[model samples]
Target: MSAADADTVLFIPGLWIHSDSWAPWAALYEKAGYTAIVEGWPGQAATPAETRRNPAPLDGVGLEAITEHYARLILQLPAVPVVIGHSFGGVVAQKLLARGLASRAVAVDPGPIKGVTKLPFAQIRSALPVVKSKKNRSTTVALTRKQFRFGFGNALPKSESDALFSRWAIPGPGRPLFEATEAKKTDKSPAQIDTRLADRGPLLIIGGGKDHTVPEVVTRQEFELYDTPAITDYKVFADRGHSLVFDSNWKQIADYTLSWVAAHRVNA
Candidate 1:
């Protein structure tokens, strides 16, 4: 397809993650004939050194700010892109879809949004250290081995999980975690991803069977909220966790996503 005709693919990372985290996946999308773009949150640069050296807290950063930043970037793309988002980014993808930004979206273990009534113990515990502090707005929380094992590595081998922890793990903003905690109570939290714009495009929700942070049950439950008849799909990786996109089998996941886009894109 011509440059103008070929579809674009944008990869948005989760909280405290940098664009480099999606480098492998971006190459995969490029090989599949899709232009790829990786975006970060406002004031959130996609670099491990910067993220680690001066990790910022999530205070004052609300969902509206996030949505607007991504929306403006999406509007600048030449072609409507297929957004593939992980964790908090998945929530952002849902919100973008609601506003008609993309032709389709893939929410891989998206973070809790408004009205999601369930909060797993593991998730709460992983977030306790930061949320307990009232001045946590400026604090950063690093994922310890235990925290990663329970929330993101229950199904992976220790070596693999350990490597991931050492390589990509960094401090994440605490505000979103705190906001997501109260997402069920108020609509103002940063986790409020409105999948209500279900008709704007097709959506695929991928669940990590062992993901304590975003358990399969909750992922499955959230799928039902996309009430539109716009061809929503769901899948669960039995041995996967929150790090599904970064796993060794990521190629398979990427292939599946590319196939879905080819089948449902605007120019398909």
Candidate 2:
């Protein structure tokens, strides 16, 4: 397909990072005749270094605001695009699907949604750096390299994990984390998802086996929550972790995702 005829793919980054995190995957998709748009959450700094230097801009941002931002972006798109998101972004992608905003969607190691009930000890420990401090709800919170290693890069070598943390880590708003955990507390929570919608489109949930933040069990439960089994699928990278998109083997995951999209191409 030529660039004009190619499908548009919107790559949504997760917490603590900017859209630049998707540069590699975006380049790969463009090379394969797709238009890739990498969108950062609202108030994200242009670069990780800048974000680390000043994170106050992200404070007080919540799931509702972030979701609405993406929803508006999708509504303005020239065509219904394929949405791919990781971590928190994954949950937002599902919310977009619920709104009938995507032609297809892929969520990688997505954060907990409304219907997922299992909360593993590892997951709790991983989020403790933020959740343990209520003050973080109004202030930006950044994870230590140690915390990142434990939560996102556990499957990688220490040196690599450290490097990735230094390069991509930044402060993130804490309200979204609180909202995700407290989703069940309210009937009209922003984290709520209607996976059974007939127009929800094709959905793929990808899990990282070694992920402490959102383990395989969590992603599996998310997949099972969708009543339309015919349009929902799940895949797991047995040796990966929450940082699967930034891991050394990220290309493998990217290629697999590309293949999945091609298989479910709207006009294929």
**Candidate 1 local accuracy as lDDT?**
0.75
Pairs with steric clashes in candidate 1: none
Quantify all predictions' global Cα lDDT against the true fold. Answer: 0.75, 0.86
Reference-based TM-score, model 2:
0.95
Evaluated at residue 103, the lDDT of candidate 1 is: 76
Task: Give the lDDT of residue 142 in candidate 2.
Answer: 88
Give me the candidate number with maximum lDDT. Answer: 2
Return the TM-score for each candidate structure: 0.89, 0.95
Lowest summed-lDDT stretch of 10 residues in model 1? 1-10
Error of 1 at 75 (Å): 1.9
